[model samples]
Target chain A: MKKVFVLVLISIFFLSVLSSLMGGVVNIPLKVVLEVFTGKVTGIERTIVIDVRVPRIILATLVGIALSLTGAILQSLFLNPLAEPYITGVSSGAAFGATLAFFFYLPAFPYLPLFSFLGSFLTLIMVYLMAKRNGKVNSYVLLLAGVALSAFFGALVSVLMVKSGRDLHALVFWLLGSFSGRGWSEVKLAIPLIPLLFIPMRYFRELNLFLQGEERAFELGVETEKVKKLLFFLSSLLTAIAVSVSGIIGFVGLIVPHISRLLFGPDHRRVLLASLLLGPSLMLSSDLLARVVFSPSEMPVGVVTSFFGAPFFIYLLIRRKN
Target chain B: MIKVHDVWFSYEEASVFEGLSIEIEKGEFLGVVGPNGSGKSTLLKLVSGSLKPQRGSVLLEGHEVSFLSRKEVAQRIAVVPQEYHLEFDFTVEEVVEMGRYVRGGKGEHILEELNLMPLARRSFLTLSGGEKQRVVLAQALAQEPSILLLDEPASHLDISYQLELFDLLSRLNRDGLTLICVLHDLNLALSYCKRLILLSEGSIFAAGRAEEVLTPENLGHVYGVSAELHSHFGKPFLTFFSPFEKVNEGLQIHIICGGGSGSLLIHELYHRGCRVSLGAVNTLDSDEVIGRKLSLPMAVEAPFSPISDETHKRNLELIDRAKIVILAPLPVGPGNFKNLLALEKAVYLGKEVWVVNPDFKGRDFTGRVGEIISRIKEKARFFSSEEEVLKELENWAS
Candidate 1:
């Protein structure tokens, strides 16, 4: 049964990759796409496939894998089903930092994500410290602190948006989230950080140990405090990088891990692997839909994901209740 | 082997354990019992390395528990906590296999040993409470620790399952696994645990073999109740009674009993503050022993001796000093046939006479005693048990 699920995910992943490469405003045909890849095409089609489509698809896949893996880790780290990168305020914190760069007129595209990384890593620490009691993190307190901090950082983002007299359009577009005009330069920075996801993957058994709660996990020989700090650091790093590249895409992180766990069991090894594969597929499909839905103009991929992912998440909650 | 040396553990501002010390030998099944807030569960946590003491150490095989590496501590001690929530949909097998994190294996041997083979593939969320507890126990045992600690393992289970779980613990102890359990039920602790420790107000109130540790005086003083400890087939048992609220003054009851039929009545009457006197009991009778234990005055005779005129005169004098007289069910043999005559004399003296389990009809060896009891039966109040007698006493006192 697990093999069949893996086979189907692989097929869907390849299909979405193929479709996302060809399905865009320029509408390159499959034949043209194949030729461009095979080095048989040139001119505008070659430029479109190589320069525009390749980086965009690569960025979408990278962000997908990053966000979904972070989402899975967050859920296990907090031992909460509703835990995600956005819900924990890492996305809002990163976005706030990027807005700081834009409002100050710092070099926008090249050095922005460094500030974003600092913003999110610091926010994770703040939330973690606020939630700790008697040497253990209370998950409910952590959730509430995440919300209050998210709102505080969101208000800062708004303040920056109002201060940016001429850059408001860019700030709002980034806040709403998009993948437009991103190139190989941004993908190059992200590729180096992608391997850090393996750190969390190696602790899959420890993550499973946490499902029985902190004390039980400790009794079972897990260094719970160290594991928690390591996961928090790794997941925050992944989320900051993804947010810097994709401008805070929503719901992909929240929904894809859940769908993976629902398809596979709650064993973290299978769930984490499935989420890594499913993340790219969902992100590519959402990006494809965002590009083609409006024809001449594209909707923000974040908007598209929220539009579909919210109701699906609600449906899952209702089904889980019954 | 485990030794807790001068352990001092506190939570927030409240101290739970203050310089408490205990030592447990290898292969000894020990039970820790206490009232709520006495830190029974905390002691287990300290021993299992889930909690560290503030001022002392828990040593397992001469190594401090909190100082050892987590895997090292886990390899020596495993705990079955009070309860756990099942939030994920892992199978029973998956849950049990998690105990093999340090030393990985299939965990099939533990699953079969715990009789969880049939439920191995079932979702953990789909199990009943007993089954869930057993699954959790299986998970802990999968660690294969030398010492097992359980905190209130039978608290939420029904009686049958409670017995079954304790029975399983006994079997595990017999197999040479050192067991330490916190139990709320004193009877189960007394029957199953080889050694018992009773804790009160965060310190050990009593500790030793169950019989010595669960003495009536210790239980009554700690729990604010009147209690007795008895043994059945060499296993200790405990019985509890209501403590006296206030002494009902100016009331007295004299009981004529033998053959162990009046011990319970004597205890109930004494606890209710009735001045009780037992009469015409032969020496070495079980009832005489109970009467002496409660310090009630009794009219006694030699063993196997019939009630003499002097003993009868003393019994009548005791009945004369009482407002109510009780006749406990006794065989009317020729040896003590005068005891019934004493009851008739008490009724003839216009005292209120009560007959408990009145069966003087065929209990007669003298043959004429039935007619005498029937003549006095109209004036006597018949009661079934001590509970009914206590109720009547309450009514009369009020």
Candidate 2:
């Protein structure tokens, strides 16, 4: 009951903040913005508000949902608080493909999403191969090797960035992570998997067992090794798709799930459900602020999320110590 | 029946056990005793199918244990291991419920029986050690197994919990459940076990009734202890008597025993670095416990008992095994009095032969002290302190 009420409050607050940002420098009144939203108002107000900001808002929300869900699943699968989609190297691997597509003068590959998906999939397979030991992949060792592998590919992506250097503006914006270029195609690419990943992961009890230690789970006949492999493949799929179009959004894949755990308990079901609602809403509002905070010159969506997530994360670490 | 036949175990190249064999009948309680790291836990692991022996086999209900699946073995036998670690904060009920995991039934009944239902809502980390151990037991019991293997189940628990655990096992045994428990507490083993298997260095030293297997000879040989064996309540009671602190500096310890008691006195003094000598200890005598360790050149009697007068002369040669001649609590008979008479010479030489008593007169040579003070002084040398004697000998060493 309390969780539902808190969700509604957060929705109203973020919705109001997003609308005010959508309204122009002259600061259109709430009624006028509603009028524009409802198509009663005319000219540039409707075009700028409904056509431009509304689509961007929806894209930010979708990307945020994708990233947070992936983060939640990855953390549970690895059984470590620090495991995130980026930590597994999938996001950076996708970024390397996008940069390579630009390097070859194939800016419009007509399949940036497919190329990114392939790169991320390859990276997941490689990591799984490296971490597999005694027919089981231990999460601690896997994460260490994954971080090392991710850094190696991250340096490779930086090299591609230097080689492709042209179309500096678009490449830089994509690297910084933005919803500026998102359209129905990107949204259509990510939408089908949301419920696919979301609904299954929301089951609490089985997930609780999976995240607990392996021997205890085994003694209870849980088939721990199988569960880890299944969850790892599923999370990598979710993260690869999300990063395909968003480029490399940072903190949503890292900080948001941890923040949700601090607010909710460590139950993955509640943490995930909270992320579905809170993740998008927070990102949408942050993206809006990023878009208009300095007027016409837009900041990356990653910048806005990190600007809020980083300090709060530090505060969480300090507060938890006491 | 569980049959462990001619099993050998090794780690890499170092062999732990060679040709070790024992049999446990259904509904029987077997207590296994051995020195530390004597492959006792390894034996349990082999029986539980957690580890496979390199040679030979463990036959559970006449089936090769390694051939069965782990779940299949778990269904037959439940083991409560020594050190337990489980991740996450599960309630005691939830933890105990894991035992019933094979049952595929709801865990409420197990939690209730394990006395964990009341603490069901609390996280598992809040429980104390004994509580945690009970939950582990509860989990194993939930399997409803016919055979149970416990590796030091009562080691971490307090004395009351230890008694409670044995009582529970005894009750389970009454209900026709077979239990094999490894224990360090010999008293607990004596009190509860129907048959005890004394293991020395990965081999069975003795395996049978508590009375026959737990004699002073066995204690001396297997455990390197100088012990007294007496009947208590129709059961054998073995107690350690320290040869360390002399009852008086006058009484010398010259125990005419067999098996390995020689090791005990030597260790007691060697650990204290106290000097010792030995006599009339036949090669096969239990006094070998000290003889092997200290390299004491004992005036040995021949392997067979019923000491002859010539052996008595050889035994008297050790009248100087120590300053005072001490006799351990051994079942004395007429044939061994020559060894006792040799001790009388030590007494004549002003060295005292002190006997530990529940009536030292039954061996029959008792007419020296005519006055009350002299008789009192003669009996005053009887000792019970295993520690003080060792401590004094240790001081002698330094």
Q: Please tell me which predicted candidate would have the highest lDDT against the true structure.
A: 1
Candidate 1, B1-398: lDDT as tens digits? 79999999998879998999999999989999987888899889989988899998889899988778899988878889898776899999999999887668858999998899999999999999999999889888988988999999998899999989988888988999999999888898888899999999889999999888888898887888888887778766889897886455557889999998788887877877888999989989988988888888889999989999999888889999999999887777887888888999999999999988766666667887768768987998888776787777777773
lDDT of each: 0.85, 0.67
Q: Which ranges in model 1 have alpha carbons more than 4 Å from their true place? A: A107-111, A125-144, A315-322, B158-171, B242-244, B247-250, B329-337, B357-370, B377-379, B383-386
Cα miss at B52, model 2 (Å)? Answer: 8.0
lDDT of 2 by residue, B148-247 (tens): 8888888999988888878888998999999999888777788889898888888888889877777777887877776766568886666785444432
Which of the numbered candidates is closest to the native, going by highest DockQ?
1
Q: What is the C-alpha RMSD of each candidate to the true structure, in Å?
A: 2.8, 8.1
Tens-place lDDT digits, model 2, residues A69-165 = 7777666555555556666677777777666666776644345655676677677677767765654456557667767867887788777777766
User: What are the runs in model 2 whose C-alpha is more than 4 Å off?
Assistant: A1-58, A88-90, A97-147, A199-203, A251-264, A307-322, B1-90, B93-106, B136-152, B165-398
TM per model? 0.92, 0.68
Tell how far residue B95 is off in model 2, in angstroms: 4.3
Q: Model 2 Cα RMSD, Å?
A: 8.1
Worst 10 residues of 2 chain B by lDDT: B364-373
| Alpha-carbon shift of residue A101 in model 1 (angstroms) | 3.1
